[model samples]
Target: MRTIRVIGIGTGDPEQLTLQAVRALSEVDAVFVLDKGSEKADLVALRREICARHAKAGLRFVVAGDPERERRPADYAGTVEAWHAARASLLEALIADELGAGEVGAFLVWGDPALYDSTLRILERITARGRLAFACEVVPGISSVQVLAARHRIPLNRIGAPVHITTGRRLAAGLDPEADSTVVMLDADPRFDHLDPELTIYWGAYLGTRDEILRSGRLGTVGPEIRRVRAEARARHGWIMDTYLLRKPGAE
Candidate 1:
């Protein structure tokens, strides 16, 4: 059976790679990268740089086109499931065609595989099919959320209060009053505009990289500025990966 390593390389920073992840990369015979088109070419470049820094000298890189799905589907979960199924199918073919029996292959994930990433789920789907047999392992790395807190010098939680992590789509519905802190990820749109004005926001974009942008203040004070900056950054870079921590009025 072929062995697949789902290694987390962290958010766009080669140095964020853990020692364990480095060792894992050294063992990989080939690494698969999903091309998300020219708009995110820098993401692909970063993956290449990470492999160059850690993987064995002769390690191979296999690039494949990522399947696209609706950005604003009526059924978000269903759309994502379909997209992941397509990814699983593509990755399965790549592994069967590119990897030799008993050889080790890898997918370098952004942030911890246990987070919002779909690589683990895609691998599960592939295993469920049982058409191509491979053993999978995960090596965790620093996440963008961790970087956000570190850059802002704030903990994710307040005292014993629980932290809520949610997507932009969910955040649009409402913030949880019971949770003292909320970390919002994968927000293509600025959904926080309608949130409580008194809340404080610690936001970061393209974190752990030189292009990192950070903003912090009362939501009412910096909300508009963040929206402007975020738009400019996205337009300039053609892509942006951002996350923010929101603290209730009295939580801070």
Candidate 2:
């Protein structure tokens, strides 16, 4: 039987790799990396750097070109389903062609595998097809949410209050009043400006790395500045990973 380890390598810092992740890296016969294109070359480099830092010698590295997806299709759910199917097909082929019986392979995830990442989903699809036979193991890593909160020196939730974690799209629809604190991720839009000016925001981008940027203040005072800074950073780096926490006044 073949074995595949889905390991989380943390947000960005190489040192964030847990000892379990390090041991998993050492045992892998091959490491698979998805190339997202030249625009995000830094992302690919980070994965390679992690492998170089932790994996045992004589490790084989496989680089696969990621399938492009429609960014703004009319049917977002359908488009994502199709894209995932394509990715699963590609992964299935890679496993069959590259991994022999009893060999160990791995894919390093950017954050916790159970988070916003689709690698685990794709792997499940491949295994469910019954064409490839592999046992999978997961090793959790530090997530960007944890890193963001830690860097800001804040708790995710107020005392006995609930924290709502949602995407930028859902946030644009409406803010939940019951959620004392809301954490936003995958925010391509500046929806924070829609909230009351009295609300406070703590934001971070390119977290756990040298290029990290952080900002905090009342929404009215710092929202525009965050937007401007975010635009400049995206233009400079070709891509950005950011998250933020918002708190209503008197939320405790």
In the range 7-72, model 1's lDDT, one tens digit per residue, is 988887788999999999999999999999999999999998888888897899999989999999
What is the lDDT, from 0 to 100, of the residue 65 in candidate 1?
89
RMSD of 1: 0.9
Name the candidate that leads on TM-score.
1
Clashes of 2: 0
Candidate 1 backbone collisions, by pair: none
Q: Please, what is the whole-model Cα lDDT of each candidate in the order they appear?
A: 0.92, 0.90
Write down the TM-score for model 2. Answer: 0.97
Backbone clashes for every candidate come to 0, 0
Stretches of candidate 1 exceeding 4 Å from the true structure? none
Error of 1 at 238 (Å): 0.5
